[model samples]
Target: MARVDAAWYVTAGWALDLFQGRQTRDHDDIEIAVPAHGFPDVRRALSEFELYAIEDGLAHPLTPETLAISHQTWVREPATGLWRLDVLREPWDGNTWIFRRDSRIRLPRTRVIAYTEDGIPYAHPEIALLYKAKAVREKDEDDFAAVLPLLGPSRRNWLAKALTLVHPDHRWLEALRAGSTDTAAR
Candidate 1:
């Protein structure tokens, strides 16, 4: 794989593991988020692999038009047909990380992301949880359960406010508001 110097952060289910400082479960594919504006750099870096824009349950070779419309892309090795990466193009305003659901809700990229001791960047657990909130699947639920207890007041408060804006009536709001650290009941 080729390496590129760009702002990329581990996201989704894998993000929870990064925040927890360990591997919590097996991951089928690694997920990374890049600013929509920097997608060209990513494409150049992964030029050896096949990149497909995933739209409405279909995979299409990425073209300028497809790149403009699709938010998610999957990278695979053509020979083996093995999916290697899941890339999420995220909205950004210079250095701010704009919430995909609500552009009005944004934070400085530095504040919304965390890095490991070795300098690997990952989305903050709260931000990852916010994305997971949209689809409360079994894995999402498990991820939420694992990360909730690790959140402190500031993180919890931030997530609560974000949820209020994006999903006012979300069930997780109550738990976050209550500052519940109980993961067992989840």
Candidate 2:
């Protein structure tokens, strides 16, 4: 794996684990978020790996135009056909995190991301949960359950507001409100 001196943060399930300070479960592959404009740096860093643009169940060699067509790119080792990494391209304004679903919702990169003991940056739990809101798969639900009890008031509040703005009637909003009440009770 090549390392780039660019802004990138671990996301998805692994991000939840990073916030909890431990790996809660097995992960199939690692997912990372990189600025849409900075993807070229990532590509250069991982030049040894074969990058494939994945969209609508199709995978093809990633080209400069691929960024405009797909938000995700999967990298693999050509020799062994082993998946190496999953890259998620995200909209950003310098050091700010822009919500893909709603560009109006933006936060400073510092607020939406945190660094591990080893200096690897990972998405904040609240931000990760916001992304998980759309899928609600068993794994996503499990991740929410695990991290909900651990969230502080600020994180819970931010996530609640974000959900309201983007999803409105999302069930997680109710759950987050309930969790807030529970936290207050404790």
Candidate 3:
């Protein structure tokens, strides 16, 4: 089996694993995200696994830094076209750290969760979603839909705070509050 990163489980992936439970069905491809400087380390660490890089850059760019160092992973899929393995990156400088996430966060360690097509370790489900949300694209929205219900109250709060910074004008926030209203029934 391939090695995997087990530490980075975000609420989304955790929710997917909880709600979907060990996917019996085959997935197109798995996705993961890591800080940019860490990408080379991850790539070097996973050298034994089948590695293919995507030039088109399908995943959402996490930041301007992510754009500067755009990357995507491609694993061969016999029927579903090329499956994407994306890694989202954000710049880190302890002096000017302006990220909006809560302080209790931890960067996950690399571990073996599942193997890739060529037997490289893929990232865990929760880690995948955490990274996926960083991109915040249409597909990521679909991902949120599939996994949002799985998030617990605390994680949801974290997600809300994070997105509030990322998308200050986000309509979903209003919709969410409306959904919570008892008066919506009237």
Q: Cα RMSD to native, each candidate?
A: 1.8, 3.2, 8.1
Task: Compare the candidates by TM-score and give the number of the best one.
Answer: 1
Ranking of all candidate structures by their TM-score, best first:
1, 2, 3
Tens-digit lDDT string for candidate 1 (1-186): 236566888999888999999999888789999988988889899988999999987889999888877899999998999999999999998999998888878999888789999888899999999999986877887888788889998989999999898888777877787887444434
Write the residue-wise lDDT of candidate 2 on 4-98 in tens digits: 76788999999999989999999999999988888889999988889999888788789867657898999999899999899999999999889
Q: List the residue pairs that clash in candidate 1.
A: none
Instruction: Please give the range of 10 consecutive residues that has the lowest summed lDDT in model 3.
Output: 1-10
Q: How do the predictions measure up, each by TM-score?
A: 0.94, 0.93, 0.47
Q: What tens-digit string does per-residue lDDT give for candidate 3 at 1-186?
A: 124332211223432443455543334444554444555555555554444544464543234453454545433344554543534333333322123243334333432134434433444443444445555665555555555555565555554555565555554444333333122221
lDDT on C-alpha atoms for all candidate structures: 0.87, 0.86, 0.43
- List runs of model 3 lying over 4 Å from the truth: 1-15, 18-27, 48-68, 71-84, 89-142, 175-186
